[model samples]
Target: MPESTYPRTALQRGGVPVPPLALGSWNTWDRMSKDEAVALIRRATELDAGFFDIAYYNMGPHAENSRTDILFGEALRASGVDRDGITLCGKLWLWDWPNQGFRQQLVESLGRAGLERFDTVVVGDYGKVPDMPRLVAEVNALISEGLVDSWGINNWQIAHTTQALDEAETQGVVAPVVAQLKYGIARRSMAEGEAYGALFDAGVLTLQASDVFEGGILATGRQPERKVGADVGGIREQIAAIYPEVARVAAGFGVTPAALGIAFCLSNPATANVLFGASRLAQLEQNHAALELALAHGPEVRAALAGCWVDRDVRADGVW
Candidate 1:
């Protein structure tokens, strides 16, 4: 059976209403100049994409650059977006999820971003798989200290996230609500495969989906470099194979493939927020417009693109 698709408008993070689209700063460093990046941040704010996504990994050499939070801070300060108006979501490695290590990492991340608190902090991918009980304790402590509003996991396999949620429930701490994962036409394992479909069925709704463009696969104009963890060549082929169909469907609706892709995710009723990345104001505006168009044509596009999902051996290929 095909995975169920859902559509939802907003979700509350620390009492703030989050729109369905967010600004993702993954590997955005050096893609544009500082001034341009700041302007882009302001642009995102104007477009209601104020839920900014950042992580420590985005700052390290893996991206060949650094300090996404710092960049966002600069943009926020310059853009005049009130701290309370926009929400910041940060990611940490599992190794930092226990004891003082988690707290210290949060402190550093906050300091770098020039903020006292973030709306949500997630343990990005299970690196060494932190001790679940201790990890929950550390997360609860942060919430108690008011250092973070809500907490969750990102990029964790279904089994790990399921275990984390169960343990959090057993331990009587706030369970992780937002489980960030990759989901798009090019990366359909989590969305269509049973691995994460079960999670949605389990009542988890806040799925902050990133890479909706599939590392430049679905965009209309010149695509920026693909900057994510996946089989670049293989994904390119998958996108190539589907581009004609996506373009045809998009043209049929008088929208771009980018809009088709975003709409495809928006079609999923359970997805709370879909994250998109941009290094320029124009791109941000484009995606923001596409987001609204997606909402309008979400169901139709989902039906059209039903056969375009890259549902290869997900677990065997390690995409999960």
Candidate 2:
């Protein structure tokens, strides 16, 4: 499964094909200048990474405007990548729910991307079971009108995702083809546990983000000194302790630490794609190298790395 050998895995979602690995513009956009962001995106396109995930609410609390998507749109136009060959995936944030607000948000996403329509629009993390019906309905409506080619959910539990799919079936509409979940060596429940089972049975595609364990915690042996809000910091510490072993395993395959982390996600049968966020052209080149590394590492190497999930904090409840 070397990056080059794989070419790019494509899955049919809502009768459209989407790239198996998507370029995510989250922290990458926040950290880079607008020009840097555009360069990184262009580099990804040059490498044939055909999907970009942009968020309208990426700028942080005080920022009323979403410059990230706009910058991405400008870059796409400037690069001259045929819109037909690329898939633009954006999110519908919590604040932009309900009819009018959601419609406005969708319009803004299109405006920002400088595209006529998105290939996939993920309505993210409803957080509760009750809210799913409305969100699914709204997303289906958007799909019906050709505003978006497909719909998806991000950061949701198995139960909530299943409920949403059930609702979609009841309405005779397609359920989400993708579920964007936090999945990596440091984060596994959503991919390995009951959540994966539910999604698999329902024929939903799995899209994993934060695959490098959020900035080298799992891949680079670096952990944050301060405890951020919630459960992530502790897990990072645990992952830091195991980084040497991870590096050793990666060395066995002659790949970088980041590639090893990504390969672990790709090894999962449920995973249809891995989402990577790159702030620079160099970073995009490094991350895209995973495709080649994957092909070089055979089943034995993949099984060995998969068996290396030994950190307890990562397995603890609330980590997912």
Candidate that would win on TM-score: 1
Give the alpha carbon lDDT tens digit for every residue of 83-103 in model 1: 776778877666434543778
Question: Per-residue lDDT of 210-295 in model 2, one digit per residue for the tens?
Answer: 44455546655776442212344345556567788888987877776777777677766666677876666776676666666655
Give candidate 1's error at residue 29 in angstroms.
Answer: 5.0
TM-score, one value per model: 0.86, 0.84
Task: List the pairs of residues colliding in candidate 1.
Answer: 5-268, 6-268, 6-269, 7-268, 7-269
State, as a TM-score between 0 and 1, how close model 2 is to the true structure: 0.84
Runs of candidate 2 exceeding 4 Å displacement? 1-7, 33-35, 58-66, 127-130, 224-234, 310-320
* lDDT for residue 201 in candidate 2, whole number 0-100: 51
Ten residues in sequence with the least summed lDDT for candidate 2 = 224-233
Runs of candidate 1 with Cα error greater than 4 angstroms are 1-15, 58-65, 95-100, 220-226, 232-236, 316-320
Candidate 2 has an lDDT of 0.65
